[model samples]
Target chain A: MKLLELSGIGKRFGGLNALTDVSLHIGRGEIYGLIGPNGAGKTTLFNVITGLYQPDSGEFNFNGKRYRAAKPHVLAGAGIARTFQNIRLFANLTALENVMIGRHVRTRSGVMGSIMNSRAMRLEEKACRDKAGELLNLVGLKKPHQTLAKNLSYGEQRRLEIARALAMEPLLLALDEPAAGMNATETENLKELIEGIRNAGITVLLIEHDVKLIMGLCDRVAVLDYGRKIAEGVPDEVRNDPQVISAYLGVDGE
Target chain B: MPNAHEAGIFKRQRRRILLAAILLVLPFAVDGILGRGWLRIVDFAMLYIMLALGLNIVVGYAGLLDLGYIAFFAVGAYCYALSASPHLALAFPQLFPDGVHLSFLIVLPAAALLAGGMGVLLGAPTLKLRGDYLAIVTLGFGEIIRIFMNNLNAPVNLTNGPQGISRIDPISIAGLSLNATQRIFGITLPSVHLYFYLFLCFAGLVVFVSQRLEKSRIGRAWMAIREDEIAASAMGINTRNLKLLAFAMGAASGGISGTLFAGFQGFVSPESFSLMESVMVLCMVVLGGMGHIYGVILGGLLLALLPELLRHSVLPMQQALFGKTIIDPESLRMLLFGIALILVMLYRPAGLWPSRVRRRELSSDERPDETA
Candidate 1:
C-alpha cells in the first residue's frame, strides 16, 4: 500500500512558482529519493509536506488519511517526522534533551500534570529520556547524554537530528540533505544509519544533491527541474533519463 | 555513578531546594528580629520578582520586547481599587447607586482576567509588528492607559483622576482580615508583615509556574521562537498564538501583582505606573537571564531591593561626607542604577544568571561552516 501520496501540489512565493503540479508516491517501507538542482523546489516540497507552508493546490494522503494544513506539532503527532538540510537541532539543549523534545508529542502528561510532577508524568519523562539515550546510541554518538548538542561535530549533529526525529516514533521519516557537509567517511556512516532506519520498518523520503549517495541508497528516484517532476523510476533509469542528464548531471559533469 | 554530570545535577537541585526553603522562612525571621521596615522592603522585592518573571516570558523566552508592561500593572491596581473600594459607588453613582463592592477573592481573579483581556487586545494588532515597532506601540498603549486614568477622573470621577484611589481595603481570608489590626498566631501583626507573607506566597507561585512552563512544550516553543521564528515555524510551532500567549500570560502576572500592590499600599495613581517602572522590571529580567526562572527572581530581588537599600544608606553617608544632607540621595541612587545597567549590558549581556539554554547557545561553537 502507498504509505504517502501527494497529488497536484502547487506552491508560489509572490510571482515565483517555486513548485507546480508536483506529485509523487512512496510505498510502505520504501526509500524514495527526491533529486533536483538548486531552486528546483525540493526544499519547498519538503516544506509543504511537513506543514511549514500550505500548498496553493494539493492533496496529500499520509497513512490513508487526507492531510490538512496542520501545524508542525500536529504533523508530528500524526507520525510524520523530518530533519532539515541545515541541521536545526535545539542548540542550547543537551543531546538527550534535543531528542526528548521529539518525544513530547507522545507524552501523555498535560501541562497541569507536568507542573505537579505527577507519578505518570515522571514515569513517562523517564521513559522518554531512556528512548532519547537509545536513539543517541543508535546514531553512534559517543558523547555523554548530558553533552550539549551544539558541542558535537558536524556529522554528529546530523546524526543527532535524525535521532531527534526518530524519538517521535515516526512511521515515515524525511531527511533533507543529511550528508550535505559531511566527508566521505561521514556520508558512508550516514548511509548505514539510513539503512538501519529502513530496517526498523520506517519508510524514508530523502532529498540530496549528491547523486552517488542517492543512487546507492534510494529504491526509487524522482527527478525534478524548474519546479516540476521530469522523470521518476529506479536509480539506473533516472541516471539514464535524457532530461535528468540535460538539466542536472550535464552541469555537474562540466 | 560519581560522574561530573550527575554531581552537577545533584548539586544544582540541592542548592535550589535550600534556597527555596530559606526564602520561605525569611519573613518570620525579619518580623522577629529586624522590624516592619525590613519586611516592607522584602514585600516590595517579592512583588518586583512577580513582575520580572512575567516580563521574562515576553522578553526573554518569547523574544518580544514589551516596553509598556506596566500598563497591565495599572490595570490590576485600578481593577482592585474599583472593585474593593466604597468609592466605586461615589465615582460611578449611576452604575451602582446603592454601591457595589466585591470580596477580595473575586477582585484577584477579576484583575487578572481584565488585564489578560487587555494584553490580548494590545497584542492582536501589535504581534505582527517586530522589534522597535512593537516596543513603540506598547509604549504608546501604556502612556495612553495612564493618561486615560488621569483624565477619566474629571467627568465621571472613575479613577478619581490625578488624585488616584486611596484607602483601598486590605484582603480578608476566612473571617480574618489582613488590615492593620489583624493578628496571627500569638503576635499582633502589622499589615506590612501580613502583606510580606502574602507577596512571598504569590512570588513563590509565580516562580513555580514559570519554572515548570520553561521546561514544558510551550516553553520549548517559546525558546524555539526566540532563537529563530522562521525555523520555529518550520518546526510546526504556531508562532502567532505562542506570541499572544506570552503577552497574555505576562499581562496576567502584571495584573495579579498590581492587585497586591494596591492592597499593600492602599493607593493607586498614574505616577506609580510609569515607563520607568516598566524599564525597571525589564532590567530585572535582562539583568538576571531571559529564560531562567531562578535568575529572573534573583534579578528582580536585587534590582528592586538595591535602590531602596542605597537610598537608605546613601543619604546618611552623604550627610557625614558633606556635614549636611545637601544632595538628594534618590538622584544619586538613580545615577548608580544607570551606571550598573550600562555595565551589565556591556559586560554580561546575557544577564547575571543566564538561562542554561541561553548560556549554552552563547558558549557553544557548533555552527556548520557554509564556506567549507
Candidate 2:
C-alpha cells in the first residue's frame, strides 16, 4: 500500500523553477531513496512534501488524505515527519527534552492541565519522559539524558535529531542527508538505525548524497534531475539507467 | 558512594530549600533594614518580577521579541480601573448609579482575561513577522495603547486622560480590606506589612506556576519553538497556536500583576505603563537569564533597586564630595549604571545565569572542557 504519494508537483523561486512536475510514491514499510546532484531540487521536493513551501502546482496524498497545501504542523499531524539537511535539534534543550518535544503531537496535556499539575498531568508527563528516554536509547545516544543537545558531538546530534523525529511516531519518516557529517563508523550505525526504524513498521523516505550507502541500504531508488524524475526502479536498475548516469555526470555535448 | 551526578543533585536540592527559606522572609528582612520607603520599593520589585516572569514566556521560552508587553500591562490596569473604580461610574453613569466598586477577587481574573484576549489580538496579525520587525510592531502597539489611554477622555472619558484614575479600591477578601491594619494573634502589623505579605504570596504563586511549566511538555514545546520555529512546526508543534498561547499566558501574568499594582497604589495611570517600563522589564529578563526562573527574579530585584540604591547612597556621597554637586545626580547615576551593566554583561555575555543551552551557545571557550 502506498503510504505517501506525490504527483504533478511544481515549485518555483522567482525566475528559477526549483522543482517541476516531480512525482513519486513510497510503498508501506519500504526504504525508498532519492538521489540527485547539486541543484537537482531533491531538498526542494522534500520541502514541498513537508509543507515548508507552497507548490506552484501539485497534489500529494498521505494515508489516503489529499493535500494541496498543508501547513507544516498539519503535515506532521497527518503522519509525515522530516529532519533537515542541516541539523535543527533544540540545542539548549536536553537530549531527553528534545525527544519529549517530538512527543508533542502524541501528548494531550494543555495549558490549564500543565499549570494545574493534576495527577493525570503528572502521569502523562512521566510517560512522555519515559518514551523520550527510550527513543534516545534507540538512536544509540548513550550519553546522560540530561546532556544538552548542543553539547552532543556532530554525529550524536544527527542521531539525536533522528530520535526526536522518531519520537513523533510518524507513519512515514523523511530524512534529508541524515549522514551528511558522519564518518564510516557513524554511517554504519545510521544504516542499522534506519533498518531498526523500518523493522518497527515505519516507511522511510531518504535523500542521501552518498551513493554507496543509498545503494546498499535502499530497497528502491529514484533519481531526480533538473526538477524532474529522471529514473526510478530497484536500486540496481536505477543505478544502471543511462539517464541517471548522465544526470550525475552531465551530457558531454551540452 | 553515590556518583558525582548524585552529589550534584543532592547539592541542588539543598540549595533550593535554602533559597525558598530566604525568599519567604526577604520582605520582612528588607523592612527591618531599610524602613517603609524601601519596603514599598520591594513591593514594586515583586510586581516587576511578575511582569518579567510573564515576558519570559514570550522572549525566553518561545523566542519571540515583544517590545509592546507593557501594552498588556496597560490593558490589565485599565480593565481593572474601568470596572472597579469610581472613574467607571463617572464614565458610564447609567451602569452604576451610586458608583461601582467590585471585590479584588472579581477584578483580578477579569483583568487577566482582558489582557490575554488583547495578547491574542496582537499576536494574530503579527504571526508572520519575525525578529526585529516583530519587536518594532510590538513597540508601536505599546505606544498606541498608551496614546489611546491618554486621549480617551473627551468622547468617552475611559481612562480619565492625564490626571489618571485615583481612589481605586484596595483588594479585600471576605469584607476584610487588606488596606487596613488589624491586630492578628496579639501582634500589631502595619497595613504596608500586610500588603507586603500579600504581594509576596502572589510572587510565590507566579514562581510556582513558572517552575511547573518549565518542567512540563508545554515548556519543552515552547523551548523547541524558541530554538527553531520551522523545526518545531515540523515536529508537530503548531507554531501559530503555540505563539499565541505564549502571548496569552504571558499577558495573563501582566494583567494579574497590574491589577495588584492598581490595588496597591490606589490609582491607575498611563505613565506607569510606558515604553521605557517595557524596556526595563526586558532588561531584567535578559540580565537575569532568559528562561531561568531564579535568574529573572534576581534580575528584577537588582535592576529595580539600582536607581533607589543610587538615590540613597550615591547621591549623598556625591553631594558630600563635591560640596553642592558637580554633575546632575540623575545623569551620573545613568552613566555609572550603564557602564557597570556593560562591564558585568561583558564578563558574563549570555547572562548572569542563562539557561544551559543559551550559556553553551554563547560561550564557545567553555565548550572544549565538557564532554558529550
Candidate 3:
C-alpha cells in the first residue's frame, strides 16, 4: 500500500512557478528517490511535502488518510520528519540536547511538572536522555554526545542532524540532499545508514544530486525538470530511457 | 565500571550541591568579615542577579530582545506600592475602606501577576516584528510607560508624577511586621541587613527555578527557538506560545524583584525605571553568559557591585598615585568602564561566565580562537 501519495501537487512563489503538476507515490518501507538538476524544484517538493510551504494545489494522503499539512510542526507530529539540505542543528546545544529537543513531541511532562521537578518529570527526562544517547550510539556518535553540534566534524554534524530527526520516531523520513557535501567515503557510509533506516521499517523519500547514489539506493526513481516530472520508473528502465539520457547528458550529448 | 553518562551526571550533581552551599555561606562570611557596607553591595548585586536571570529567559533562551524589561519592574513596584501604601486610601478609597491595606504576602504575588499581564500585552503586538524592528518597538513601549508615569499627576494622581511614592510598608510575615524598629529573635538588626537577607532569598529562588527550567523540555524548546525559529516550529514545538511564555515568566521575575526593591527602599519613582536600567540588565545577561544561569549571577554581581566599589576606592587610590584626584571620580570611572567593555567584547565576547553550551559554541571549530 502507498504510505504517502501526492496527487497533482503544484506550488508558486509569486510569479515563479517553483513546482507544478507533480504526482508521486511512495510505498511503505520503500526508498523513493527524487533527482533533478539545479533549480529543478526538488527542494520545493520536499518543502511542500514536509509542510514548510503549502502547495498551491495538491492532495497529500498519508496512511490512507486524505489531509494537508499546513505547518512543519504538524507534519512532525503526524510522524513525518526531515533533514535540511544544509545542516541546521542547534549550534549551542549539545548533540544529546539536540536529539532531546526532537523528542519533545513525544514528551508528556508540561511546564509545571518541570518547574516543580516532579518524580514523574525526572523519569521522563531520564528516559528522553537515554533515548537520545541510544540514537547517538546508533549513529556512531556516542562518545561525542556531550559535544556541541557546531563543534563536531562536518560529516558528524550531518549524522547528528539525522540522529535528531530519528529521535522524532517518524514513520517516513525525508532527506534533502543528505550527500551534498560528503566525500566518497562519507557518501558510502550514508548509503549504508539510509539502507539501515529502510531496514528498520521506515519509508524513505530522498532528494539528491548524486545520481549514482540515488540509482544505487532507491527502489524507484522520479525525475523532475522545470517544475514537472519528466520521467518516473524503475532505476534500470529510467536510466536507459532516451528522454532521461538526453535530459541528463544534454540534447547534443555534450 | 560506571559508564561516562553516570559519572557525568554524578559529577554535575555534586558540583551543583557544592556551589549552592558556597553561595549560602559566603554572604554571612562577607557580612562578618567585610562589615555592613559591603553587605549592602552584596544585596544590590543579588537584586541585579535576579533581574539578569529573568532577562536571560527572554533574550538568551527565547531569542527575543526586550528593551522594555524595566517597565515590568515598574509595574511590579507600582503594584506593591499601590496595595501597601497609605496613598491607596487616597486614590481608591472604595477598595481599602479600612485604611492603607494588603499584607506583604498578598502584594508580592499580585505584583508578579500584574507585571505578567503587562508582559502579555506588550508581547501580543510586538510578536509580529523581528530583530531590530522588535527592539525599536519595545524601546518605544518603554518610553511610553515612563512618560505616562511622569505626566499622570492630575485628576487621579496614581503614581505621584515624579514626586514619587514613599513611606511604603515593610514586609510582614504572619503577624510579625519587619519594620525598621522591629527586633527579630531578640536581636535588633538594621533595615539594610534585613533587606540584604530578603534579596538574598529572592536571588536564590530565581537561580533555583531558572536552573530547573534550563534542564526541562520548555528550556530545550526555548533554546531551539533561539537556535532556529523556523526549524523549532517545524519540530512540533509551538514557537509563538513558547516565546510569549518566556516573556511573561521573565517579566514575572522582574516584578518579584521590583516588589522586593520597593519594600526594601520604602520608595519608588518613575526615574528608577528608565532605558538605562534596561540596558544595564541586558549588559548583565550578555556579560555573564546568555544561557547559563550561574554565569548571569556572576555577571550581575560584577556589573552591579564593581561600579559602587570603584566609586568608593578609585578616588582614594588615584589621589595616592597622582597626589590629587586625576579626574572627577564619577566621570573617570564611567570612562574606564566604557573602555573595559570594549576590551571585553574584543577579547572575551562569550563573557566571563559562559554557559557550557555557549562556551562550546564559541570555542568550536566554527568560531575564531579567543580567551572568552
Candidate 4:
C-alpha cells in the first residue's frame, strides 16, 4: 500500500527553481531510490519531504494524513525520520544518547516529572535507555553506550545516524547519501542494513550518487535532472530509457 | 562489578554527608572567625548560585546564550516588591488600602509564573535566531527591562521608578520573620544567619533540580539541539517548544531567586538588576563550568566572595607596602579579576571544572583521523 504520496511538488530558492512539478508515490515495505545529477534538486526534494523546506506548491499525504507546511518536528512526530547528506550527529553526546534523543517523540515526560523524580519518569527513563541501547546494537556500533559520536569512525557515524532515525520509530526512513563515503565492505554492510530495515516492515526512501548501489538495491528508481523528473521505473527499465541515458551519459560525459 | 559499584556508591554517600556537615556549619564558622559581614557575603553567594544555575539551563544545557536573564530576576523582585510593600497603597488605595501583603507561598508561585511567562515572550521571537545574533537580542532585552523599570514612575507609579520599592515584607513561614533574630534550640540566630540558611535551602533546591535535569531525556534533547538544531528536529524533538521551555524553566528559577533577594534585603531597586549583574552571573556559569551544577555553584561562590576578599586585603597590603595607600583598591581588584579571567581562559579553555563532553571536545583534535 502507498504510505507517502506527493503531487505537483515545487520548491524555489529566490530566483532559481530548485524542484518543479515533482510527483512521487512510495509504497510501504519497499526500497525507493532517487538518483540525480548535481543541482538536480535531490536534496531539496528530500528537505521538502522531511518538512525542512515548505513546498511552494504541492501537497503530501503520509500514512493517509494530509499535511501542509508541516514543521520538521511535527513531521517527526507523524512517524517520518531522516538523516542528512553530510552526517549530522550530536557529536558531543554519546552514541547511545544520540539515539535516546530520537526517542523524544515516542516518550512523554515534562519538567515537573524531571524535577519531582516521579515513578512514571523513572520507568520511562529506563525504557528509553533500554531502547537506545538496543538501537545502538542493532546498528552494530561498538562501545556506543560510552563513546561519543564524534569519536566514532566515519562508517560508524553513518550507522549511528541510521540508528538515531530508527529510534524515532518512524514509518518512513529517508536517507540522504547513506553510503557516500563508505568503502566497499562498509557499503555492503550498509546495503544489508537497509534491506533488513525494509524487511522489518518500514518504507525506505533513499537519495544516492552511487548508481550501482541504487540499481542493485532499489525496488523502483526515479531519475531527476535540471529540476525535473526525466524517467522513473524499475531499475532495468530506467537504465535502458533513452532520456535517462542522455542526461546521465551525455554526448561528451565528465 | 557489582561490589565495585556498591563501593563507589558508599564513597559518594560519605562525601555527601561530609559536605553537608561543612555547609551547615559554614555561616557560623564565618561569623565567629571572619565576622558577621562575611556571613552577608556568603548569603549573597548563595543567591548568585541560584542565578548561575538558572542561566546554566539556558546557556549550558540548551546552548542558547541569554544575556538578559536578570530581567526575570527583576520581574520576580518587582512582583514581590509591589505586592508585599505599601507602594500600591499610595498609588491605588481603593484596591489595596492596607497594601497587598501576600504570603511567601502565594507570591513565590505568582512571581515564577509572571517571570516564566515573560521568558516565553522573549524566547518566542528569538527562537529562529541563534549564536551571536541571539546574544545581541537578549542583551537589548536586559537593557530595555532596566530602562522600563527606570521610567515606569510617571504614568501610573507602579514600580516607584528609579527610587525603587522599599519596606518590602520579610519572608515568613507560619509567622516567623527572617528579618529579625530569633532564639532557636537555645541558640541566638542573627538576621544574617537566618537569611543564610534560607538562601542555602533555595540554592540546594536549585542544585537538586539542575542535577535531575542534567541526566534526563529532556536534557539529552536539549544537548542534541545544542549540537545541531536540524538533526535534533529530525530526531523528533520539538525544538521551538523545547527552547521556550528552557527559557521558562531558567526564568522561573530567576524569579524564585528574585523573591528571595527582595525578602532578604527588604528592598528592590533597578540598580540591583543591572546589565553588569547579568554579565557577572553569566561569568559564574561559564567560568566555573557551564554544564555542571557543582561547578556553577563553585563559580558563583568564588566570584561572589573573591571581590570581597580582595577589598579587605588589597587596602591593607597597599598601606603596608607604601606606608600609605597608593593604588585605588577598587581598580586594583578589578585589574586582578581581569587577569584571573584571562589566565583561566588561557590555561583551561573549556572551564575550571569542564564537563566531560567539553573536555573531550577541546582535546578531540589530538587523535588521528579514524573515519575510514
Candidate 5:
C-alpha cells in the first residue's frame, strides 16, 4: 500500500515554476528515489512534501490520512521526518542531545510537565536517551557524550543526521542529498544505510546526486527534468527511458 | 565505578548543605559587619537573579533577543501596585470605597499571569523577526510600555503617570507582615532581613525550575530552536508555540520580580522600567554565561552588587590615596563597569563560563585544518 501519495502537486515562485503537476506514490518499506538534473525542483518537491512550502495545487495523502500538513512540525508529528541537504544538526548540542531533540515529536511533555520533573517524565526522558543512544550506534557514531554535533567528521555528520531523523520513529523518512559530499566508500556506506532503513520497515524518500547509489538502492525511481517528471519506473527502466535520456543528455545525443 | 559515582553524589549533597548554611546566615552576617543597607542590595540581587534566569529562557536557550523584558517587570509592578494599593480605590472609588487591597497571595500569581499574557501579546507580532531586528522591536516595546505608563494619567490615571504609584502594600504571607520588624526568641528580625529570606526562597524556586527546564524535553527543543529554527520545526518542535512559551515564561519571571520590587520599594515608577534596566538584565544573562544557571547567578550577583560596592570603595580609596575627592565616584563606577564588560566579552566571547557544548563549538573551528 502507498504510504505517501501526491497528485497534481504544483509550486510556483513568482514567475518561476518550481514544480508542476508532480505526482508520486511511495509504498511502505520501499526506498523511493527522486532524481533530477539541476533546477529540476527536486528539493522543491521535497520541501512541498515536508510542508516547508504550501503547494499551489495538490492532493496530499499520507498513511491513509488526508491533510495539508499546515506546518513542518505537524508533518513531523504525523510520522513524516526529513533532513536538510546541508545537514542542519544542532551544532552546539551533543550528538545524543541532537537525537534526543528529534524524539521531541514523539514525546508529549510541555513546559509544566518538564518543570515538575515527575516520575513519568524522568522515565520517558531516560527511555528517550537510551533510544537516542541506540540510534547513534545504528548509525555507527560513538562517544556521543563527549562530541558535539559540530565537532563530528563530515561523513559522521551525515550519519548523525540520519540517526537524528530516525529518532522520530517515522513511518517515512525524507532525506535530501544525504550522500552529497561523500567519497566512494562513504557513498557505499550510505547506500547500505539507506537499505538498512528500508529493511527496518520504514519508507524512505531520497534525493541524491549520487546516481549510482540511487540506482543501486532504490526499489523504484522517478526522473524529473525542468520541474516535470520525464519518467517513472524501476531503476533499470528509468535509467534507459528515452525521455529521461533526452532530459539528462539532450535530444541531439550529446 | 559505582563507588566513585556514589562519592560524587555524596560530594554534591555536602556542597548543597554548605551553600544552604551560608544563605541562612548571609543577611545577619551582612547586618553585623556592613549594615542593613547591604542586605537591601542582596535582596535586589536575588530579584535580578530571577530576572536573569527568566531572560535566559528566551534569549539564551531559545535564541530570541528580547530588549523589552523590563516591560513585563513593569506590568507586574503595576499589577501589584494597582491591586493591593489605594490607587484603584481613588480612581474608581465607586467600585472600591476602600482600596482593593487584595491579599499578597492572590496578587503575586495574578501579576505573573498578567505578565505572561503581555508576553504573548509581544511575541505574536515579533514571531517573524529575529536577531537584531527582534532586539529593535523588543526595545520599542519596552519604550512603549514606559511611555504608556508616563502618559496614562491624562486618560485614566491607571498607572498614576509620571508621578508613579506609591504606598503599595508589602508582602504578607499568612498574615505575617514582612514590612514590620518583629522580635522572636530575642533575635530582632529587621524588615531587610525578612525580605532577604523571602527573596532567597523565591530565588531558590526559580533556580530549581530553571535547572529543571534546562535538561528536559522543552529545554532541548528550545536549544534546538536556538540552534536552527527550521531544523527544530522539522524535528517536530512547534517553533511558534515554543518561542511564545519562552517569552511567556521569561515574562512571568519578570512579572514576579516586578511585583516583589513594587512591594520592596513601596513605589512603582516608569523610570525604573527604562531601556537601561533591560540592557542591564541582558548583560547579566550574557556575562554570566548565557545558558548556564550558576553563571547567570554569578553574573546577576556581581552586576547588582558591583555598583554599590564601587560606591563604597571608589571615593574611600581616593581619600586614602590622594587625601581628596577628585574624580566623581558614580562616573568612575560606570566607567569601570563598562571597561570590565568589554574586557570580559573580548576574552571570553562564548561567555565567562560557557556551557560545555558551546566551548566545543567555539574551539572546533581550528579542527578542520587538522582533519584536512
Candidate 6:
C-alpha cells in the first residue's frame, strides 16, 4: 500500500522556484533515499511534506486520503513527522522531557486534569514516561537521561532528535541530513539506527548527501537537480544514471 | 531500594511540617516583634508572589512576553467591586436595592473567570504575534484597561472614574469576617493578622498549583513551545491552544490576587494597577529565575522587601552622613537599586535560584562552539 503520494508539488519564493513539479510515491515500510546536489530543493521537499510550507499547486495523499494544506500539528496528528536539517531539540529541557513532549499528542490530559492529577492523569503520565524511556533506550542513549539536549554530544543529539520524533508514533518518518556532521563511525551507527527504524515497521524517507550511506541503505533512490527529479530507480541503476552523475559533477565537469 | 524510598518520603514529610509550622506562626511572630506596618509589607509581598507566578506562566514557561499582565489584576478587582460592593448600587439600583453583597468564595472564582475571559479575548487576536510585538500589544491592552477605569465613570459610572471604588466588602469564611477582629479562646486576634493568614493560605495554594503545572503534561507542552515553536508543533502539540492556555491560566492567577488585594485594602483604584507595578511583577519573575518556581518566589520576596527595607534604612544613613536630607532618599533609592540589579545580573545572569536546565544553558552559552 502507498503510504505517501505526492503529485505536481510546486512551491516558489518570489522569483526563485524552490520546488517544481515534484512527484513521488513510496510504499509502506520502504527505505527511500532522496539525494541531490546543493540547492536541489531536498530540504524544501521535506518541509512541504511535513506541512511547513503549502504547495502552490499540488495535492498529497496519506493513507489514500488527499490533503492540499494542513498545519504542522495536524500533519503530525495524521502520522507524519520530520526532523529538521538543523537540529531543533529543546536545548534546555532534559532528554527524557524532550521525548515526553513528543508523547503529548498521544496523551489526553487537559489543564484541569493535569492540575488535579487524578488517578487517570497519573497513569497516563507514568505510561508516557515508560514509553519515552523505551524510545531513548532504542536510540541507544543510556544512563544520561537527565542530561540537557544542548549538553549531549553531536551524534547523540541527532539520535535524540530521532527518538523525539519516534515518540510521536509516526507511520512515515522523514529525516533531513541525519548524518550531516558525523564521522565515519557515527555514520555507521546512524545506518543501523535508520535500518532499525525500518525493521520496526515504520516507513523511512531520508535526504542525505553522503553517497556511500545512501547507496548502501536505500532500497530505492531518487535524485533531484535544480528542483526537478532527474532520475528514480533502484539504488544501483540511479547511482549509475548519466543525468544524476552530470547533475552532481556538473555537465562541463566543473 | 524500598528503605531508601521510604526514608526519602519521611524526610520530605518532616521538612513540609516544619515549613508549615513556621508559616502558621509567622504573622503572630511579626506582629509581636515588628509591628503591623511591616506585616502589611509581608502580606503585599505574598500577593506579588502570586502575581509573579501568574506572569511566570506566560513569560517564563510559555516564552510569551506580556507587558500588561497587571491589566488582568485590574479586571479582577473591578469584577469584585462590581459584584460584591455598593460602587454600582446607584447605577444599577434595580438589580440590587441594598447592593449585591456575596461571600468570599463566590466573588473569588467570579473574579478569576472574568480575568480569564479577558485573557482569552486579548490572546485570540494576537495569537500570531510573538516576542516584542506581543509585548507592545499587551502593554497597549493594559493601558487601555486603565484608561477605561479612569473614564468609564462619566458615561456609565461603572468604575467610578479616577476617584475609584471604595467600601469593598472584606473576605470572610463561613460567618467570620476577615475585616473584623475575632476573639478565639479569649485571645483577641487582630484583623490584619487574619488577612495575613488568609493571604498566606492563598499564596500556598498558588505555589501548589504552579508546582503541579511544572511537572504536568501541559507544562511539558508549554516548555516545548518555549524551546522551539516549530518543532513543538511538528510533534503534534498545538501551539495556538497552548499559548491561550498560558495566558488564561496566568490571568486567572492575576484575578485571584487582584480580588485578594481589593478585600484587604477595601478599595480599588487605577493608581494601584499601573505600568510600574506590572514591570515590578515581571522583574520578580525574571530576576528570581524565569522558569523556576522557587526562583520566582525568592525574587518576589526580595524585590518587595527591598523597597520597604530601603525606606526604613536610607533616611537614617542620609541623616547621619549629610546632617540632613541632601537628596530625596526615594530618588537615591532608585539609583542604588538600579546599580544593585545591574551588578546582580552581571554576577549571576541565570538568576539567584535558576532552574537547573536554565543554569546549564546559560553557563554553556558562554563557552566556545562545540557542535559542528
Stretch of 10 with least lDDT, candidate 2 chain A: A245-254
Query: TM-score of each candidate?
Result: 0.90, 0.94, 0.90, 0.97, 0.97, 0.96
Clashing pairs in 1: A72-B236
How displaced is residue B345 in candidate 5, in Å?
Answer: 1.3
**Candidate 4: where are CA atoms >4 Å away?**
A252-254
Instruction: Please tell me which model should have the higher lDDT, number 1 or number 3.
Output: 3
Pull out the clashing pairs in model 6.
none
Give the per-residue Cα lDDT of candidate 3 at A135: 92
Report lDDT (Cα) of residue B169, candidate 5.
91
Best-first order by lDDT: 4, 5, 6, 2, 3, 1
**lDDT of candidate 3?**
0.85
Q: Whole-model lDDT, candidate 5?
A: 0.90
- What is the CA-based DockQ of model 4? 0.81
lDDT of 3 by residue, B1-372 (tens): 579889999999999899778866665677789787887788777778888999999998888999989898888887887777887666677976644768888889888888888888898898767788988988888888888888777798788889888888877668766556457689666666667667777887887888888889999999999898877876778777888898899999999989988877789889999998998898888887777887888888888888887888888888889988777867876787788778878877888888766666665756653220
| Per-residue lDDT over B1-372 for candidate 6, one digit per residue giving the tens place of the 0 to 100 score | 999999999999999999999988898899889898999899999999999999999999999999999999999888887777887777788877766688879999989998998998998888889899999999999999998998898766788888889998888889999888898789788898888888888888888888898899999999999999999999998999999999999999999999999888889999888998898898899889998999999999999999888888878988998889777768876887688679779988877899988887787777785553
Q: After superposition, how far is residue A174 of candidate 4 from its true place, in Å?
A: 0.7
Instruction: Order the candidate numbers by DockQ, best to worst.
Output: 4, 5, 6, 2, 3, 1
DockQ of candidate 3 against the true complex: 0.45
Candidate 2 lDDT at A29 equals 97
Candidate 2 CAPRI assessment class:
medium
Interface CA RMSD, all predictions: 3.9, 2.9, 4.7, 1.2, 1.8, 1.8
Instruction: Provide the clash count, candidate 4.
Output: 0
How would you encode candidate 5's per-residue C-alpha lDDT over B31-127 as one tens digit per residue?
9999988989999999999999999999999999999999999999998999888887767879988777898889999999999999999999999
lDDT of 6 at B353: 92
lDDT (Cα, tens digit) per residue for candidate 2, span A1-254: 99888888999899999888988899999999999999899999989888998898888898998987789899999888899999898887789988999999988998789889988899998998999898988888988898888888888888899999998899989999998977898899899999999999999999999999999999999998888898998999998888888888786524
Candidate 1 runs further than 4 Å off: A249-254, B1-35, B94-98, B126-133, B230-241, B323-327, B355-372
True contacts kept of 2: 0.84
Return the clash pairs for model 4, or none: none
- After superposition, the stretches of candidate 6 with alpha carbons farther than 4 Å from their true spots are A252-254, B94-97, B185-187, B320-323, B360-372
